[model samples]
Target: MTETSTEGTGTIEALSLVPKAEARQSMKDFKSDQEVRWCPGCGDYAVLAAVQGFMPELGLAKENIVFVSGIGCSSRFPYYMNTYGMHSIHGRAPAIATGLASSRRDLSVWVVTGDGDALSIGGNHLIHALRRNVNLKILLFNNRIYGLTKGQYSPPRRSARSPSRRRWARWTRPSTRCRSPSARRRRSWRGRWTPTASI
Candidate 1:
């Protein structure tokens, strides 16, 4: 008598089987015990809550996520997250996050920065990261003023108020209509390819 292999049958059975239980993990699992220290009415609280709420959807291992931040009010993000993080110098979060993401593909890298911290001292770093398409998520909080620095005017504000009316006019132009044809082409290309690629 010949005996048939049960391995294929077992594999088929496993493939057809459904999960017996729902996920036990909750958003609270990602919540850090650290006290949220943002001032009342600060937008940081909303940003923090949004990040925490969205994080669980990634379903990543807690240790495999990293948050890097520059010196500013929003830079305190790394401290509130339960995952691994680094609070870096002013306007250096993008560079640090780029390094981390490039070196560790298994990790989810996020950079938390403020308008002044990123667009002022870190502008070059931010542009390079975006241009290179670095595998990092940047959360730039633009509150128009420097919150951590006691409400000083920021780079965005300076640009808006500068004597160069031409620059202000260019900046104020509607982005979608004002972009160059090359930029429009790039956007169209990305819109067509990214959806299928993501799936």
Candidate 2:
């Protein structure tokens, strides 16, 4: 195992001689007993499921997994996971995860953040973590609106639109390429009404 620093710099000093199958089983043992809780139609459900399913593939010991999240509707991720986790303050998940990732070589750190909690006030921390590549899996939930704040507009919202709607548009942009032409056309209707420049 190797130890890292809070500054996002580190080196792997030793190789684990653990066999692949044994390591995989060890990781699987770390999964927790909590039931997932997210809105029926919310994207968070998928994100959570994906993470949980993917985690065991790493084949690390259960003690090596850590999930940290900032406050938001999405921040509840830690509660649903069986592994070690921290439901941190608003917009501070990355910073907290960064520190943990830098200092703990045995742990696989993951940060779960939302658009409001991350981009709004935690933007600086997010950027630094990404740039430094601090051996973390940063899962950003970009729903556009501040769901925990009762559907309010978030920082990622466009300036020209209502805060609530602007966030939706911002979140949807990344999916445009994957969408069917008909879906893209439907989205274009909103573009015309709101003006593409606003987005």
Tens-place lDDT per residue, model 1, 1-199, is 1011222232223212212213544578768888988888776777787778877765566777789999988888888988899999988888988887767766667788887888778877877665555456677777767776665566555345555543433343222211334323322112211111222
| TM-score of every model versus the real structure | 0.69, 0.67
Model 2: per-residue lDDT, tens digit, 1-199? 2233333234232113212335345333544677666777777766666666766766655566778999888888888877789998978888899888777655678788887888778877776665555566667776657775576666655443665555445443322111334323322111111111221
Where does candidate 1 have its weakest 10-residue lDDT segment? 187-196
Candidate 1 global lDDT: 0.65
Report residue 126 deviation for candidate 1 (angstroms): 0.4
Runs with alpha carbons beyond 4 Å of true place in candidate 1: 1-24, 158-199
Root-mean-square deviation of Cα positions for candidate 1 versus the true structure, in angstroms: 12.1
Q: Go through the candidates in order and give the C-alpha RMSD of each one to the true structure.
A: 12.1, 11.0
lDDT of 2 at 154: 66
Q: In model 2, where do residues sit more than 4 Å from their true spots?
A: 1-31, 158-199
**For candidate 1, what is the TM-score?**
0.69
- Judged by TM-score, which candidate is best? 1
